[model samples]
Target chain A: MTDTRNLGSQTSLPTKKLKFHKPKIGTAIFLTVWSIYVLIPFVIMFNIATMTPHEALQPFAFGWDEGIQFKAFSELFVDLCMGFTIFGAFLNTLMYSIPPVFIGITVGTMAAYAQSKLTWHGRDFTFGYLMFCWLMPDCVGMGAGYMWFDFLGWTGTPLPFMIPGMFCGVAQVFFLKSFMSTIPNDLLAAAKVDGLGDVMVFWKIVFPLTLPAYWCQIIFAFIGAYNNYLGPLIYLEDPATYSLQLALRFFSVFNKDNKPAVMAGNILAVIPLLIVYLCFQDFILKGINMGSGLKL
Target chain B: MEAENVEALEGVQAEIVERQRKRRKTVKIIKQDIIGWLMGGWPFIGAMIFGFIPSIIGYVLPFMELHTFDYSQMEFVGFKNFEWLLFNERSMFWLALKNSLYYTVSVPIYLGIALFVAVQLDKHIKGTGAFRVIMFLPTFVSSVAMSIFWQFMFDKTGGFNSILGLFGVAPIDFLDDELWFMPSVIFTGTWGACANSVLFQAALANVDISMKEAARIDGATERQTFWKITFPMISPTTFFQMLTSLVGALQVFTSLQLMARTDTGPNGAAVSVVLYMYNMAYQWTGPDYGLGMAGACGLMYQTVLVILTLIIFKTKKRWVHDND
Candidate 1:
């Protein structure tokens, strides 16, 4: 249907029409260097993970007995002292992360649904208030959160992490609510006429439609809670209740007795997140489109 | 009289039916309202307490001296901590603020370079997805791991300086030097933040092709099209990135914490405001809870950020384009 002769000229006309062109040789060279720059750190991390401390320190000249220190992983799982182990830290992180995921999703969905579906006065003001939470730095209120948690007798408990996390879950609500708004209003009306209540509508109709975004929020909340070092560092005094990030920080320092193991431990700790991102890269992009600024 | 009685009975029946229907409608509406509230209520309540309350408390606490061990000992410090922050040479607050500024400057410079590289890959170049994945890989890597990797790389005789020798540049002590310390951390941090730039590049890809074509047809150069057309479309994304980057730069702890060797670093060369706050609260053997809470200062931090946000928002009308 189209003219083939014009196609080439149509696309190339801009460049051909122009008299001057900036040279891309500099750009090409820069790309090469930048690619290498991005790659080298990752390559070095992988290399260090696979080698002993003594061997890792060796000038990364490729051929050095093909050293592999896979035992450092087992050491993390095996080593325990005075009721503290790497597994305990992993569990602690899970404890800190899981509640917030549930609570954040729960609270965020409610606020979003209220804002989107309900006819309440000052709804916009409520949303503006929530957005203020996202705008302010989280650390600004840490001292206060710490004091409040202490007052509630929940300093060392998982409640401190989960409670504050729910408050900060406005981002998720913002994402889910916006996604919820895109749903056809007719479907909701139909359901309402069929005698379905709002809760059933949210659960059966709205929530199902939003599962993808919900999952994305879940993953985000989990990772954020998982990687939170400062919260646990301040609120959690008991080493038994320390998060994975805290443990990793601890291991990086206190494990001076076993440096290779620490490096290997670092690799192991990060692998699960890599696995998650690799699997959900597409969803992450979709999630980003839905909630642009909230991406950590 | 019999006809009048029949008419009255009919009227009564009609009225009964109307009342029943009205009741049913009211009940249904009420039920729906309850379900909606229940579905969303707990989260809102939780947010009100933990989310809203602490922010108010954060503002209020800075003016008053707070002690965890002794709650009754509260007194109005009345900007004494701020005075200490401004005039006290021993306090690392000003230095930390300086470091944060330097860190903030690195964001635009690095993001610009990263955006430039990303545009190259965005040309539907071979293995674009793979390159994206590789670039994004560092973002997934834990800050701990990334910091450790940097520490190893710059360890006095490590490959960083060794590689510098290839360019005939002498080995400069990175971790120890006061000038180089923050810059080295910033450089390492910017290396991994390429993910944000790539994401921005993807957003740029979504930019309307017609505008770009129009620019091209108008005898505009590629650079001109990019500056006038493409960049404006992506301004919202850039603004979003800048906000997050500013917040992140202000709260910089992990990289500095790691590089400064939380245990071994000097008396506050690499100590950020956050790290200082941490030290004041927990790190010291006895832990100066009062001083820490005094210094866990929010007013200046909030004031500066709020001002920055206002400036950006005010200027946004000029730069940020909303297609809608």
Candidate 2:
């Protein structure tokens, strides 16, 4: 006991190890207000989701009215076709999201490899031009895409939405390029000396190495393609071809009276994203965390 | 063994040179280039055809008039569309333009506040991640979803009024009144904008912690550190947010479209540019496609955005810091 006390005294050194940083009153107040401000919509949505349609349509009250209305979920499923069948829209989202995810990852890997590995002429210039194109407002090309698709007589089809979404994004190229640049050039040289063909080196070696960046590109491509509104809004004239967002837009149409069920629909629409966020929480956050940092 | 290795190296070098020489031959180079082009070609071709070429067409279309749907019977109207838009008092162009400006100017303010909120969440406080996720929930919620939520929140008998009641303040008409329309739009807009704030937070986290420590040790206040050090470090992100925000502001379609049913203040109040364009093109039977095209004019907007970007880039020295 005496030896333990002596050892503890030696380590303590009669100095305070922890220093507290005082929290500012102004910031505390501001954060409280900001937190409430951010919580308002979520509270409203969460409350509305539980309220009966009549209660929802009724003047808002502070406390819970008639307990929870879990029937909204069943109602949404039942009236699915009334406001773009939630299941169909969900399927449509998957269909739209999958192809771009694959194409973005594949083509992004190839382009990034060419830019980083190949000493081909005009590589930097080409890459820079692509980045420039990425900066252009998506709306600038939107109307033109509509006109072009109209001329092609492919306006109402899913092709316009899916194909352009698959191949056209420059953000993926920029992302993958930054990732590929980090790979050591010595690896490529060694692989070449080992008699690996360019294609073999890429597929067998370089491709496997860039999986993290590939996942990043996949998540981005999936989200962007799935949430696409303006393209489908313009190019797709058929109701049947309506994307989930477009389907949701049908709910916002306040013809005779407001459809509060659409609020339920909106809440339900976000369910898929929540699932995605939960499943790929790490990749989504990591992707976003790294995306802006590596812009150079 | 050394000699054999040298000879092997020499043979490899010769083979490489011969291949390079063959690659230099015009025909062979052209063939290989075609293959290369094909491999890297789809995206470029798609971008040019779908994006570049079409924009060029769109740019020139306002200068010409399609008298009918016939390609052969087109007449060049020169600047008539521009004249119609600029000088025509009957058109809703000025009102829409004003509304568009309102939308554009509100973004920086919204985004500024958003950044501040983001900074607060990034302070490593308890429940910050949960708050970030909750705030970000609205972003994943579609605009249609946003409109629904806002409609409920801002309803006369809605949450806005209830909150107002708690403070003993009378309810105000949010959606119907012209004076309140843009503010309501901005309010709804800010609700869904928390995702962007989280993105800023993410960017801020990536900022070198050492710099913050250095600033702290130098006795800089929190505000000073934010403005002098943190702000400059995250300027790239700020610029990106500004650019995207501007683009989103200019294309303010859905919100305006939803809000259109509500009565405008006396003489045509709440119509935005895209709404006005839609109204002209589709609302009336004598569809003034030319007039609609004039109102849907993107070139001026594009030029302004491009110039703003260039200006920002040029003046980046004042704010942006890239630590080598």
Candidate 3:
């Protein structure tokens, strides 16, 4: 969008004016190769999912001769069960992912609103505290979280994953806070003059206004919970309660001979996220930019 | 006299109403403050319980001999676990530490490649948006799935070897060979470089075009202008990217876990610190919580070092131009 024609025109020096130019062939070739490299995994995943085991070993066959074997998906859903089927794992992933996102967003929105809109004592301190919590890696807490869950007799249940999620989503709080800070103070003041209390004003004015940011937060939280492996691996002893990610690992381990089935499980585990990325690509990109754009 | 009395009564009524209004306003302000506290207080409390308490416990757990989950059984053992990890010649901890630090080499490789690609993509190009999406697609895939995909590709009879076969080159065992294993892992790590590249592209777009043009008019070459004008303008973003990439590299686990099948592959070359800690805590011959806590403590020290380094870089922010 920068006008390259007028770019060097302002300078007194007699130089050639810069002009917007098409991407050279070399650039196109480089990007094409990079794009192929990036996409090779998905391509391989799909190809192997359709292939018979013998054909899969060939490494080049697409299994198109058999015309796209949908049987692998059926097998993933129906045949594979160490204790529970992949369908059950999918449902379990949803259960673990959705409620936490819901709770996290609700809690995050409230905290962000309070930090950005409401004036109170200890507000800045609390915001800083949340930021500190955000900075610490999540894995550092795994050992203690496991023990804490064990103490509360909550291990082998979804509570270990969901309970902590309800309380401490510092990332969500930070993202939503940054977005909320952009809202004009006069808008909230006008709402206050109309007899709207702080809570009502947040609910009516702030929440709706920051819905785009919420969407970004929701996608990120959902993807995180859905793809989480370590949390379930450490805390949940019950095979029946494993999320799709954990289940996929087990599926590959247990069904080592069935490469097609393992590939099918992999594809199934990634499909929801793939769909999310494809649909909300712009929002996801914006979220990544916003996150990176944050000053320390 | 009657009219004057009426005016006097009206004035008194107005005063009463105004006073009542003032009192109501005060109460409403009080109520709003209470609401603010109610809304804001829960998250902080939750953070304390879930975030702060656990982190504090994680720090202290290293110093305590945790025989079992029971707090009553835990005994204080100052620096004993650390001594075992650091001083004991037979500890896998040293090898794991070395491998973990080595894995950080991917940070620069990834960033350098990403910055290069991003710079190229920043030019006027057709279908750049589509190209960006294609490039970024791999990052959205789950790490486990991608690891599996990579494992298949790196298999002895996999596509990579098959492609090499066409060139009459001998097949190499990418995962099993000691020399090749870490590079394979680093290669897999670079697959997610698109995420960083996209971020770099955004940063590049935000650089001041006017400054770039002025440099051009001053007869500076393209490379010099980029280095002198564009790079410094985006230094803050570069710093952020470096910090995140380093932090991420330090905690590299999933690919190693999946590719190595939870065993450190090929001379313990693929064992990251987190994966080592995970094994110590859960997959050890027994649950050695103290040793695992020691690993966590070590990770904390590393994190602190990273933060300190970041702070030092932040102090040099004078070079970063704020074109806003």
Candidate 4:
């Protein structure tokens, strides 16, 4: 437990332990003003999504004379989105996102363990290489990314995303390495003396110690994969291959100027992500929102 | 003769023991290497293949003059592609270059605001956690959705303008005006700035309260204590946040595209290096000589980033407050 307490500082949790005192009205005022700025967009989104099409002309009115209508939500499912529904888009997004992250998590844990626990001749050099890999192919031009992947016979395929995302998770490895390194080396040495091999030590001791860290990376990976737009836009031009983001983008374009429906589709597109966040908020919110740095 | 034979046998046995030890060391080296490779090497290879190979290809392709992306027919053209990007009237490279820098200019401002807000939130204020959640909500929402919402807000008769109109100010077409388009994009960025505040919140928590108490006991004023101690304490994380966000800001794509709700904003004001690269590759249907050109411009942008990052790192010792 003492070993795991370092997790708090390593990831930098700034909650619960800190003492608090009564703040003045100025703190209340400033926080409220900022909170409005943060949350007003969500309010506007919900307003537009539930508004009648006529009232949507004044989308920011925040009034509902005809009351809130769920019609746009239904219509978004039925006739909006060209031919695809939000659920289908969600599935397509899952196909593109979830598997790579699941695989990346396991791979990242192993890589992180090896990085922090193992000794090899060029281990630090390998760490440097992984950090270099973290520079990522984001700098790859859309045309060049396409052409390069096409040259490899992977253009218009999921392989481009899956291949890179699953393996090029050096950021997660770097993050998890920080967590894994905090586990005392003496524990592993003692385990080894008791006949536990590296693999067994990892499985029996290191993994459980670092389990919470995995969820953090997994959430990061899932959101990253879910929100990926340009990758699919360049590689998956076919409507069938579109990720949720690409699908919503094209859905609005394909549908004939139905503002409320588009707004509703936007709302639907964000639901699963919000659910994922809420589910993992306990662990992640504690950890300084590593997300703010990793992506944001 | 008997004594000499015994000594020779003992020497032979010692040599055999040495050989066995050498073989065991060799086996141990191979085993450790194998374990390292098994755990981490495969993913490292995948990273190299998918990351470095494409990047190197992208780097090399720009120097060739090929109508098709095909390499066999590509003729080496030196810097012709770069010359086109710089000199071509039709190219939007300069606008993208300008816009990329303009977007990054908000980093310090937001980070400053974040640090200030973090100090306030670090107090035992009720709902600070809730405030943090609200601030980070934008991260969960896709940029597409955020853009669409902001697009309406920045509309001529939309939320912001209407509020302005109540004060008798005339409406400005934020998305269509070149002056306002980039500003509107920057405005959308303000909402996302809260994300950094969350990070700073953690950084503030990690600062040494004891140091602050010591400063106060020494008769330091609150502001003086903050500037002299707390600020320096958080400077490393601040530097880190600045580095990562600058990289992210340079790659700002979705907002510029989706907010203006155009392929390019008014008079190409919203075009980013990545967006322009997308245009060169995807928009024209003919032979993709533009592909190489896209590669050229992208390389220029990355080179600038690399240089800029190196410069920032070089300057780190001056401001980053290493806790030695």
For DockQ, candidate 3 versus 4, the one ahead is 3
lDDT of 1 by residue, B1-324 (tens): 999999999999999999999999888777655655555454456668887777677777777765544657768877766776667776666877776676677777767766776677666555566666766666666677677667767766666887887788888778887778877888887777667766677677777876666656657778887887778777777777777777778777777878886432554568766766666555653323453353445556667777887787788767667744
Q: What TM-score fits each model?
A: 0.86, 0.84, 0.89, 0.91
Best candidate according to TM-score: 4
Better of 3 and 4 by TM-score: 4
CAPRI-style grade of the A/B interface in model 2: acceptable
TM-score of chain B of 3: 0.83
What residue runs in model 4 are displaced by over 4 Å at the alpha carbon?
Answer: A1-23, A79-83, A135-138, A289-296, B68-73, B285-289
| Backbone clash count, each prediction separately | 0, 0, 0, 0
Sorted by DockQ (best first), the order is 3, 1, 4, 2
Off by over 4 Å in 3: A1-23, A59-68, A79-81, A137-139, A287-292, B1-30, B67-72, B286-315, B318-324
Say which prediction, candidate 1 or candidate 3, comes out ahead on TM-score.
Answer: 3
Give the alpha carbon lDDT tens digit for every residue of B1-324 in model 4: 999999999999999999999999999988988998888775678766776687788888789776655667778889998998898887778888889889988888788888878888887577777776776677788887777677767877678887888888888888899888887788788777776677888778877776776555545567887898888878878888888888988888777777655678788888988888777766654543467877887888888888888788789888777664
Q: Per candidate, chain B TM-score?
A: 0.85, 0.80, 0.83, 0.91
Model 4 global lDDT (CA atoms, 0 to 1): 0.76
For every candidate structure, what is the RMSD over all alpha carbons to the true structure, in angstroms?
4.9, 7.6, 4.5, 6.2
- What's the CA error at residue B55 for candidate 3, in Å? 2.1
TM-score of 4: 0.91
Residue runs of model 1 more than 4 Å from their true location after superposition:
A1-36, A57-66, A80-83, A120-122, A166-168, A293-296, B1-32, B66-68, B165-171, B263-267, B285-296, B321-324
Top-scoring candidate (lDDT): 3
Model 2: what TM-score? 0.84
Ranking according to lDDT, highest score first: 3, 4, 1, 2
